[model samples]
Target: MGRHRRGARREVTVADLIDALRRYPADMEVRLATQPRMPQEHSIGAIAEADGLVWIGEGRQEGYASDGVAERLGWR
Candidate 1:
């Protein structure tokens, strides 16, 4: 038997994150950092604080029920 190797993790980009939220309209937790850092597999952070939204955290998953976030992002 051969051992399985993990595939390369997908690096989520800022634009991808915006598009996902815009198109999917699903409740998702986001992570934000004050400075530039390594990218995540499926997360994004605001480049500036003025962006208005707060970053959740890494390895944190939460349910997004109401479409509030979608409406806030103008995706609704």
Candidate 2:
């Protein structure tokens, strides 16, 4: 995933996510990668579509991500 470094913020929509996910297997497990400096992760606990938007809940903490995660994410 690339960062938006200019112009108005274009929020990622459910459609966008779906389109991207099409390249992967439907049964693939999804996890949240967060805190780039610390590189933490979490399981996906919930997903809901409401109020015209999709919500992805950052589930339970799965501990620090591998060292390469931060570098790959350009979060360092």
Candidate 3:
């Protein structure tokens, strides 16, 4: 159940909620409203609705690797 807003209850921002949820994979239907130029989603749904893999990487000088990529290309 959701807590009712009271005079003493603390307010939580959507960013805080998203940050908390980022610790786990999102598997539900979620729609977030943001600024016109802002991102609409910060996470991906575990249940894919499309074919092919979506590669998401951290913007770094060197990123992590997955052997699955090589196996998929028959290079393993």
Candidate 4:
């Protein structure tokens, strides 16, 4: 994938995300990853849409990811 465009954002539709996930094995875990510099993962929680925006809950932080995650995410 290309490097993330600075300050660029793309709105992903539920169908779009689902289609992408369909390629993965069903037993794989799903989590939210953010704070790229620190590289942590969180549990996936409730998903809802309000005010024309869909929100995915950022569940509790599970733990810091291994060094590989930062490299994979191209955050370094």
- Number of the top lDDT candidate: 4
Is 2 or 4 the stronger prediction by TM-score?
4
Rank candidates, lDDT, best first.
4, 2, 1, 3
Residue-pair clashes, model 4: 0
Give the residue spans of candidate 3 off by over 4 A.
1-8, 28-76
The most accurate candidate by TM-score is 4
Worst 10 residues of 3 by lDDT: 56-65
Angstrom error of the Cα, residue 41, model 3: value is 24
Q: Residues 1-76, candidate 3, lDDT per residue (tens digit)?
A: 1133553545454565668678777775443322233222233324332445333332222222235534433335
**TM-score per candidate, in order?**
0.25, 0.74, 0.25, 0.77
lDDT of 4 at 30: 90
- Give the per-residue lDDT of model 1 (tens digit) for 1-76: 1112464456555666677668654675454222123222334533443356544444432334235444443345
Arranged by TM-score with the best first, the candidates are 4, 2, 1, 3
Q: What's the C-alpha lDDT at position 69 in model 2?
A: 77
RMSD to the true structure for each prediction, in A, is 13.8, 2.4, 18.5, 2.9
lDDT of 4: 0.81
| C-alpha lDDT (0 to 100) for residue 66 of candidate 1 | 36
Give the per-residue Cα lDDT of candidate 3 at 7: 38
Clashing pairs in 3: none
